[model samples]
Target: MNMPPTATDAIKDNLGEAGSHLKQAASAAGEAIKGAGSAAGDELRLGKANLKAELADSALAGIAAAENMGDAAREQMDVLMDKSRDVLDSASELIRERPLTAFGIAFAAGWLIAKVARSSNK
Candidate 1:
């Protein structure tokens, strides 16, 4: 005997189909969200690494600049020392050629310094 379907049976069958479809959609959405989160985390880590690398390169450039400046300053100092040595050598030659004149100049300079000192003390 063929039995006709009741209203209750039809309603129960429809509800079961709807519930299965909803569960499948929910699972798909959850997986998509997880993938998006993982992708974002990977991008964030890559950005941090790139920033660190750039900073390191900048630091190296700065150090190189400082070293160049130091080298330039040392070169200038060497030039100044050479000029000072030349002046000293010339003065020494002048003193050797005219010992009495050099002595007189030194005596006069000492006297003048002593006089200035005494006046400042007063």
Candidate 2:
């Protein structure tokens, strides 16, 4: 003849099964949190690297613009010097063509300027 399990024995068996299931659930939860922390750290590292790359690109762009401006300023100075030489050549030609006239005009201008300055001072 077979005997049925007692009520106390059945209850203890159910408690053991419940405890095992709870332990498995707790382990799974811990693994999920660990994986999430690793993923977050990877994202933060990528963001920092991207920011550094962008800053380097911006600095390089600024340097290139400054170099271009410097080149333009040098070109403008060359043009100004060429124009100044042209003006000096014209003045020399005029003076050579009429030396006495140029000298009389210079003296007259100087005298007029002096008279005007002295009167203003008084």
Clashes of each: 0, 0
Q: Write the per-residue lDDT of candidate 1 for residues 1-122, one digit (tens) a residue.
A: 98898999999999999999999999999999999999999999999999999999999999999989988999999999999999999999999999999999999999999999999999
Residues 8-120 of candidate 2: C-alpha lDDT, one tens digit per residue: 98999999999999999999999999999999999999999999999999999999999899899999999999999999999899999999998999999999999999999
Per-prediction CA RMSD (Å): 6.4, 6.2
Clashes (candidate 1): 0
Q: How accurate is candidate 2 locally (lDDT)?
A: 0.96
TM-score of each: 0.54, 0.52
